[model samples]
Target: MQFSIAFPLAALTLLISTITAQAPGSQCGGIGWPGIMFCNPGSVCSKINDCEGLHGSLADQM
Candidate 1:
C-alpha cells in the first residue's frame, strides 16, 4: 500500500536531516555536552576525580 512507501520515505528524510544538521565539534578539554563532542584526540571525556586513574587503567597485560 501507499502507507508502506510513505513510512519509509518519511523515516529516510528524518534520518538524513538529523545527520546533516549536526553541529561542529569542540576541542579536547572543551566544555561540551556529555553525549555531544566533549573531547578531542589524545584525551578523554572522563570525570577528573581522585579515582580517575583507577578507571581507564589496564587490568591485565593481555
Candidate 2:
C-alpha cells in the first residue's frame, strides 16, 4: 500500500513539474507589446505589422 501511494505521488509530481516548465507566458501569455498593452486572440496581425491595430492600448496609461 505504501509503495503504491509513493509511486503515484512521484508520478504526479513529475507531471506537474513538466507542465509548469513548459507553461507559456512571461507576461500576459507573452504578448506584452511596446507602447501597446494587450493583444487580441485569433487576430491576423503579423509581427512585421508591429502588433498594432491588432490590439487595444492599455487603459488610462497609453
Worst 10 residues of 1 by lDDT: 52-61
Q: Which pairs clash (backbone N, Cα, C closer than 3 Å) in model 2?
A: none
lDDT tens per residue, model 1, 1-62? 99999999998876675553323222212334334332222233334543321112122212
Please, what is the whole-model Cα lDDT of each candidate in the order they appear? 0.40, 0.40
lDDT of 1: 0.40
Candidate 1 collision pairs: none
lDDT for each residue of candidate 2 in 2-54, tens digit (9 for 90 to 100): 99899999988766654443212222222344432333332222232433233
Strongest candidate by TM-score: 1
lDDT agreement of model 2 with the native: 0.40
Residue 14 of model 2, lDDT score: 66
